[model samples]
Target: MSWVHIARKDFADAGRSMMLWALTGLLILAVAGISVIPYLLASDGTTPGFEDGVGFLFSPIGLLIPIIGLVVGYQAIVSERESGSIRFLLGLPNTRRDVVLGKVIGRTGVVAIPTVIGFLVGAAVIVALYEGFAVVDYLGLLAFSLLMGLVYVAIAVGISASVSSRAKALAATLGFFVLFDFLWEFVAMAIYWTVEGSLPGFDGLPAWYLFIVRLSPGQSLSAISLTLIDFVGAEDIDLTAAGRVAGEVPFYLENWFAWVIVTLWIVVPLGIGYVRFKNAVLS
Candidate 1:
């Protein structure tokens, strides 16, 4: 069988995603509470529009998708090694490269498909509450959200490949989730403010501050989604950003390059990990 076969077989491991689904369910509940409950309480007592119901999902809900992705991918290669299954898998004609690639594909499908379904369910709720919306924009949002999840899946799978022990892989994955998702933005802001207080304030802030603010994957995805889809992330600054061309702000601050950053999160991690996994000795 081909790598696709391996992917199908691995995707049968879907029973393991209870934690991811729990988090997603909470996010959907958050979306419902934030978007739907309020709309029902409005003066007209109607559901909010597409942006109101669906847009906020891009923020708190979208931010957590990477965590779901990380959970899905954290055991991709390491679990096999831990169970002594890699030898059985390689007993067939499949190369380690095939196993790696298939795991990426299988796990990406596992994470992404549910993410899209979640968004679709949200979209359906939005439509039920409000007037109909532009389906194109809705689908666009879905696609982008799936892609964003894929980025973190790649990152987590990369981590899974690099560590030899299951404990080490779990520790490394959690550390990554903590550093980038929780700490990085806060640390960046503290430094930014410290610099501002030490200097003249407004004019003292560097031009790159805008870019620095979006260094995390969540921020980058939020910015890019806001840029690409007007109705998806109403609160993201890309919606408020002035000037459409270069010299308006740093290119990194622009949506297109923000997209590149998101893509890099997917590509760079997977590439580096691929090299590591390929070179790894399968004991």
Candidate 2:
């Protein structure tokens, strides 16, 4: 069978299940937290209408998409391993590369649909309510949302392919997702606090320190997403002087550099995991 057929079947299995329901719950919570509450509690008698609400609603998509990706992709290979079916697949003439690529594509489709739908619905609501909507900006935001999904799905698939136990796979995915999303911010904040003096006074910190912080997939992605949202008037994040200085790097240079970093976050661990899975002992 073609890998496309396998990918399609996997996509269907991942989609028509409780994962969709969980994603819906997350959408409700995020929409409510950022949009509904803020709208209802506005001190001014006139609430920001649906357009403003939708803008607010999308602010958390960056945080939520990765979690959705983890939930959707974490069992792709690990569960097969646990049930002794991975060997059966390997027994086929197919290459391990096909299996890995197919599973990643399938899982990506599963998460991508809800992400696109939620984003469209929110954008449509905003257009209906707002007098002048920047349609192009919304499209760019949707694209960024998908990138956010891709990043975590890649990470989760790597974890799945490398692990043996389904439970451990799930725990590792959730734990790492939470750590990267929440704890990483705490660590970054600690760094900022520790070097507040040097950060302001010194010529510059070592490239090593910047590289370590830049490796935070969540931090960089979230910052970029927030900047995009701010440009669209969706969110109001204050850009520090440091951020402004960083942005002054040549556009082409900064763009390619950022892409390289994002690609590394998605590719390096996945390549490592793929190598491990290819060499895994299947007895």
Candidate 3:
């Protein structure tokens, strides 16, 4: 019961943010934006439909949602401490666990609802407007998006709880998000280049390297674009296809291992953060 109230308060706090509304609007616009390309290309009968567009619509999650998570969660704990609310909340019989769980559960629910809505909206739009909508693909995307949100939110919350200053918390959280979500890909590519000769070529690469790429949130999200390519039989159309049909390339994001990695990314960080918060002394 106490947790419920805490969760409610957390939810309400997030609900008042203009950024939250902006995120919702952005999602809607993303869904609508893809409509233009199809509209333009339909004249040649070579373009895909709304279902095909769904992949691109939600593609931003590979980077956007993580940044949102960082921004939303960076202050969750440190801000309360700075304002002297942590002790007061503790006085109300709220344990550190309650505070932590409530905040995570509440905010995760808040962010995830819109993400799911965006997923469903994108899927529905594709199904209604395009002939290429596939149930498997839609389900895959929904599952991936849910896990992605969880990972990002957990990362943010963990950073929030661990830091001492609001400014430091925000900076660290943003740094983590940008570093892991965006920079990691470039790093991976660079590493690939450095070790290219010692490492296996594309044809001979080890399962571990393959696993890393697929497990990467950015990679997984990018791989979702392949769903668009596969469904429309445009596998050869987009640059994303790269060398798949032309060679031995496998669809990395579609692999189950990727989801497992994403799951681990969320679980490991949150677990560590929660344990730390549980032991933290409120000033």
Candidate 4:
């Protein structure tokens, strides 16, 4: 109950900030504006289908949503600590667990609101320009994007709670983004090269190799996305482990298992953060 009040207050405070509106506007551009690209790029006399728009949208969304989540959540708790308001917050009935939980819920709302709005506006654009508009598929992508937002926010918030300083939190979160989003593929490739004596290609990839690649939050979400949104030409190119692996797809590599991985990403960090924050001596 205290966490609920804390969550409400946190969201209300954020509601008053121009930062919230700014994020909403940015997402509007990212979802609605970026979704228009397929139509614009379509060849003459060819009207792009809804799947085409969703497929084109996946790339930018995969990149953008995580960054946004990190940015919004990184400072959620550390800022209060830095400003010495955490002592005031703690002076209230709220426990350390409540604070962390509240921050997660509040910051999640901060990301989700704009994301939902952006998707709403994007739906209009897709309906107008695209030939076949599948409402279920559209909702699927939106749900996945929201889930992605939650995963990153949980991570960033966890970092914020564990760190005493905002700078340290920022550094850790940025390092996470750079490592996972930018260099994880290279890391996986290097492991594959070192072990297999050659780089992994489209098919014939080992199960362990695919598992290593899927460890990143983005990749896990991407795997889940294959199930969520039916991209144009998805039949021709199989992104799933079943398509890439030589033998049977391992249970861990199954499409449904990606959700388990993503859930772990959310839970492990928050659990660790809560434990650290719980034991910290508040001066």
Report the number of the highest-TM-score candidate: 4
The window of 10 residues in a row where model 2 has the poorest summed lDDT is: 238-247
Tens-place lDDT per residue, model 1, 1-283, is 4677778888876646575466557555654555575466556755466666566555666766777789889998989988998887888888766777788888888876666656656766777776668687777777776787788888888888787878988999999888888897566667767876642233323546556656778778877776557673344433322332224566566667777888888777777777887788887
TM-score of each: 0.83, 0.79, 0.76, 0.96
Give the Cα lDDT of each candidate.
0.71, 0.68, 0.64, 0.91
lDDT tens readout by residue for model 2, 77-192: 88888888777667777577777777888988888877766666665555544445666667767778888888888888888888778898888887887677768746654676
For candidate 1, the clash count comes to 0
lDDT (C-alpha) at residue 95 in model 1? 73
Q: Give the CA lDDT, 0 to 100, for residue 137 in model 4.
A: 91
Candidate ranking under lDDT, highest first, comes to 4, 1, 2, 3
Task: Give me the candidate number with maximum lDDT.
Answer: 4
Model 3: number of clashes?
Answer: 2
lDDT of 4: 0.91
Model 1 spans with C-alpha error above 4 angstroms: 15-35, 44-47, 190-204, 232-248
* Model 4 worst lDDT window (10 residues): 233-242
TM-score-best of 1 and 3: 1
Give, for candidate 1, the lowest lDDT window spanning 10 residues: 237-246
Instruction: Give the C-alpha lDDT of model 3.
Output: 0.64
Tens-digit per-residue lDDT, 1-283, candidate 3: 5778888898887788786687777655555455444655566666565454654545455455666666666677778889998887788988777887777777777677677766667666666566665677667656656655666777778877776788887788767756666677566556766766454344445444554555555665555445433444445354342332334555442344454565676777677777887888775
lDDT of 2: 0.68
